[model samples]
Target: MGVTRERAIERLAGRHPGRRGFGGSADPAEAAAFRHAMRGDHDLNPGVTPPSTALTPAAVLVPLIDHRDGMSVLLTQRTAHLTAHAGQISFPGGRVEDADPDDVAAALRETEEEVGLPRDRVSVIGRLDTYITGTGFEIAPIVGIVDPPVPISIDPFEVAEAFEVPLSFILDRRNHQRIEREVGAHNRAYFVLPYEGRNIWGATAGILVNLAEVLAD
Candidate 1:
């Protein structure tokens, strides 16, 4: 039988053993390996400071849904006209506002504003580590579970399309490709997952890669 919404929430809420709940199940050996690998990366280091002068705090909602076959993650493709990361696959989010009290609030508010997902329908499980992007924003990733069969209306000005990718396909290391390029004076390394003519890269890819590493563990 497939995992029900209650079962998934129970797992995330620490009702299950050795499982840091998000949306997927993790084997003991895989979790250990992922932790070991994450420690070596500077970006994953919690102490590293972000380079951007704009102290704009941002929150992103990483929506995980339970499909009959398996789990899938909801992502959005930004319209080409956007000023920032245009034409990139990303989680629905934006800068924190004075009206928003916390990361979860900001994420929910942004999701409603950007994608027309009602705030009340989402059940927030917990949060992952905070990731600092090179682009001048400290991003907090809020993981949440949405009851399936909910309707989504996309805002064309901000989101070109909203789609889901099987979480299992992303968790596999084989699909995660590392690329090297020179950014200014330094050689930078990043990840890219090219799917359906869309190039998933940069900070967006980094966030997914981190989440994948966490779940794979």
Candidate 2:
């Protein structure tokens, strides 16, 4: 069974188990304003700039809730053949094309092309903050609500598998685990959510952390 609209909304509204410092506690108005500023404007975070000089524009489609289990977020694992971030868990998206009018359109178009998810079936709610990846792509994360019972076809060349994680599980503050690792010559700290068999970390996890903060507020 697919998730219903009411159930999805309820899940988003419910308290998240993984609530951490990353998920700021603020009033709805303040939180909404922060989210809006982050999404609308690019320079919200002036201190943390892109590490690389390359600037490829990309858009990620964050599908929230497919009907059967109320509200679940869809994610994908990229095929190892990819040049960048191969074998990493990520949202369905890619570099924007000249044919796409804007970021949102590009995201929807890419989702359809990569995952066989029809654009018409997705209702975009809003966008999250843009993230500058270490690999040089400036990614705009667009959150959308997908109706249940929709069929999906995965492109074997780009996507290894497609799966859904309950939004509630993602939203809960307790599930967000913080850890440190050595990257190159420096130590790096990040969040990780080990869902099913997939280890969602790095840029993908950072995006989810931002989303969790917004939803918690």
Candidate 3:
């Protein structure tokens, strides 16, 4: 790809604020209202996060791997036995633990723990908007560049397998679709990115869209 790591960083820096959401959101605690709003709003399947609701803070690393041919994003398939989002595609990350210093630190730490990708091998360039899920998670999507690819060693309990999707493909909004599903007697619509026959949906898909918009030319 013609977009170099430096160029990606420059593009991210172009944003007025590093991230956005309710109350300039990124922290779900700042979540203002909970309504059935998903018409023009980019976020679909958003759940009720009343201002008083204390959402669990989480972070995920949107790892952009640098290859000679181009850039690709590293994603993971959660182990089928896991509780939430079992067997679904996701970026490497988890809840922000008390031991972690901040969102970035938690993202890097969780990444290393989940996929054995070293913290030192990645350079965090920027972030996408904070995303809230129907399951009550306030996710901080931290964008990072990974150079000098490392052999992935996945945790069997947390990840089933690790894979990559070309960044260019994800950047093309055309590759995404708005699909509706019935959840608890209600219809909820969300974006889905199909890659190699696998469907990347929900928050993972939303974050990918966020990345595409943030790095748009």
Q: Top TM-score: which candidate number?
A: 3
**Collision count for each candidate, in order:** 2, 15, 1
TM per prediction: 0.78, 0.77, 0.85
Expressed as tens digits, the lDDT of each residue in 19-77 for candidate 1 is 22211224655533333332122353344334413335788998887766677788899
Runs in model 1 deviating more than 4 A are 1-49, 52-54
Question: Which sections of candidate 2 miss by over 4 Å?
Answer: 1-49, 52-54, 66-69
| Winner on TM-score (1 vs 2) | 1
**lDDT-best of 1 and 3:** 3
What tens-digit string does per-residue lDDT give for candidate 2 at 1-217?
Answer: 3445654455445332221111122565543343333322123233333432335678989898655546788999999999988999999998888898888899999999889999998887667667666565667787788877757999999999999888777777788888777667766666789888778987788788777776653
Q: What is the lDDT of candidate 3?
A: 0.79
- Looking at model 3, the pairs that clash are 21-25
Ranking by lDDT: 3, 2, 1
lDDT of 2: 0.71
